[model samples]
Target: MHRVRVLPKYLSKRLDRWRSTTFSENREWFSHLASHGQHPRAMFISCCDSRVDPVAMFEGEPGDFFLVRNVANLVPPCAVNRELHGTSAAIEYAVLVLGVSHIVIMGHSGCGGVAACYDKCEGVNAEWEKNTSFISQWIEVLAPGYERIKDMDGDRSERLSAFEKEGVKVSLENLLTFPFVRAAVEEGRLVLHGVWADIGSGALFAYDGSTESFVEV
Candidate 1:
């Protein structure tokens, strides 16, 4: 196993304090959630990056949102494939079972997976790509944004940020691919949202339904 460092005395103390105090403070809510089951109003599909936690970003408590995290936060259209179906399963449960009224696809800046797609990393073999074929195909959603901004270069950071935001819009569109999700939206039972988080600045931007553009949250 890759061992993580546990040095830094001040950080260690903070961790200990969080474990002891935070766990105790939050345990009651956890118990309540387990007893009553989740009654979340929204389903959040977000990136698997440690820095982009949906619960933390939304200031949500347990049972507040049905959450799904995956590479680049991509939601594949419901397919018959028997392979990994974690994201799809979560969406099914959240929408069909839990009856969440809103579905939010949250993407963020400084996304390694998105960056890899944009850079077109070499040395990745065909077999490896086949194994992770879903990721490769899903990341293609951002191709338009990449094509638009490939030449305009001032800061790589800014360009990547734009790509990340664009990816959120792509995911929002992807959510409509599922028939159930589409029906729900058509009936006004569910709403879809795109959100972009700025990791560098700790700022959030959400797609405005009226403007069809990302605005500060």
Candidate 2:
């Protein structure tokens, strides 16, 4: 039997090189950002999945988007709560404080959190139950898309794609629950978008409000 090396020397050297080059190249810009705080053009709500990095997916540079990530990227309706919640606080700060022009709720294909909501499990953690309550409660959010393609599905891949696209619409509807977010859109101060990214095909889909359809972005 052969044992694999735990930490490769080249990996560490590469990280060191990146730290020096990336930091030096953007040091002045980062310093200005720190001094003035983030004045981002958009706020992106996305899942906490390690594979689904919004900045990398969007090809964004530093301070380009005010990002919030959670188990499923589900935005709960804004309400006063005693305990400190990072996701909600981030949303409030992005909308009210930072005054972002756009709020994009991005859902992706092959989301473990969303899949978990559709399946039953045992010995689930209390924290998971607390955080994922919205996901279970909002089953209607993903139902329509599933229903639409259930009978006519060409293959497993096609069905899964439909499900992910539907989930985006569901999440977009959920975003309207936040009064500040809704009011901002109504007042023409903000715009909302539902986006789906297919990891298998490396394709990006954007929801067209007028046609109520998802188009490649």
Candidate 2: regions farther than 4 A off: 1-15, 79-85, 121-158
Give one digit per residue, the lDDT tens place, for model 1 in 1-217. Answer: 4687757999989888987897678988878888988899999888889988889877987678888888888776567676767788888888899999999989988898778667653334453255467667666655666766677666877877877877777777767888898999999999998888888898889899788788898
Q: Where does the lowest 10-residue lDDT sum fall in candidate 1?
A: 120-129
lDDT of each: 0.80, 0.75
Candidate 2 at residue 33, lDDT? Answer: 88
Task: Please report how far candidate 1 places residue 58 from its true position, in Å.
Answer: 2.0
Which pairs clash in the backbone of model 2?
none
Best by lDDT: 1
TM-score of each: 0.78, 0.76
Error of 2 at 36 (Å): 1.5
* Model 2 alpha-carbon miss at residue 2, Å: 33
